[model samples]
Target: MSMIKAHHLAVSYGHGEAALKVVKDVSFEVQKGETFGLVGESGCGKSTILGALAGRNKQWTGTLEIDGEEIGQKRTRSQLAKQQLVFQDPFGSIHPRHTIGRTLLEPLEIHGKDRRQERIEKVLTDVGLPLNFRYRYPHQLSGGQRQRVAIARALILEPKILLLDEPTSALDVSIQAEILNLLKDLREREQLTYILVSHDLAVVAHLCDRVAIMQSGGFVEVATRQQLLENTVEHPYTRILMDGSRGYVSERRKSDSAALPA
Candidate 1:
């Protein structure tokens, strides 16, 4: 079943006549429990699409359906909780002044959910954080740890869909893999759906079952992971992205090889 369906989606900043469109006539479907990726260079409107899905941008116009129900700007609290967004920058997403426990409790409190302590502990464990870390503030945690808290906060509401906007782009290269692995495990355990946006083809290839290549505010091509791995993409833009990712991997491998002991 399609967990998310979007058609003719458009987003613009500013009013008419002065409006600058960022996403133009975009469309796609993400099946339940599937991770769909939007990949492109910066400013390609991938994040804008995520924002629209999360109801962050009311200026958007399109048909957006989540779990078969059409979504609008004025979403009910329950409807809003059905889809959660984990932002790219963990530092920016979390409240520096609030302890991790307080941060996680906010969502539950807003929804009037009981057993806050139990929920907080479970989400922390689910994100691989020690239960005591709940007393720490965002600034006290490492970048990776903060991101884990961010993921935990997003999951505390038990949202079925996650809109990941460049979720790992700001973390250390070594830490990125760990975060990705955690997300993969959590998705399987929770039966969650994902719409992940990123400029890194390698990240998308690792996490997404299918990917859409975006350029100039629209999707240039959409292909399954097998097609991407097999180099079966036909679009020039997608070809360029694939070639660039390959080049980066080759260079990084050579660098690692050169650094090895003789």
Candidate 2:
């Protein structure tokens, strides 16, 4: 069975004269522990699709089944916890006033009152944060540390699927590598399923198992990393986007994304 299934998923904002469809007829399924990527230029409805799946965009009309449970117009927190979204800006995702430790504990409080102290500590350490940093505020940590804290918060719930909206975009290249490595480690350890949305083909290739090229507002083609990097896709729009992003795909990083589609 699939972890997520969306059939003819369409999203729009406003109505009548002001209506604008963000994503039209988009369909795909993410299997257990599989990393499916959504790639295209900015404003191509990648983030919109992510929000719809998260049940944030109310104007959308579609069928979304997550882990065999259907999502109607509204889904409660317990229902939403089955799938979690990690936004592009880690700073925005986390509250600056709340310390790292408290932010991680809120989810536990919402779900149950018994408290899971051991679970919180394990997630914090697992995300590459040192024990001493637990009490620190968001501003006290560096960009990379803050991002790890965000990831730690998401993993605290132990969701079956993660919707990553450019999780590494706000960090530097080196820091991006660290976050990527951390994600890889967590994916293996937790056996998590990921639906990553990004404009960076390099990032998509490195983290995703299957590549879906979204153009305008719909997915034009879907293929493997080898097919994308090797310029093997025939879809005109996919070819164009690939050519535009070719400079980012130099020989230096080819070795890095080579083993990604596993």
C-alpha TM-scores of all predictions: 0.93, 0.91
Worst 10 residues of 1 by lDDT: 253-262
Tell me the tens digit of each residue's lDDT in model 1 across 165-227: 999999999999999999999999999999999888889999999999999899999999988
Candidate 2 residue spans exceeding 4 A from truth: 248-262
Q: What is the C-alpha local distance difference test score of candidate 2?
A: 0.85
> How close to the true structure is residue 247 of candidate 1, measured as C-alpha lDDT?
65
Which residue segments of model 1 deviate by more than 4 Å?
A: 248-262
For residues 1-262, what per-residue lDDT tens digits would candidate 2 score against the true structure? 7999998999988889999998999888989999999998889899999889877887777688898988887888878788888888977888989988889889989988355788788888899888767788999988888889888888888898888999999999999999999898889999999999998888888989898889878988888877876667768787667656767577666666444442
Pairs of colliding residues, candidate 2 = none
For candidate 2, the TM-score is 0.91
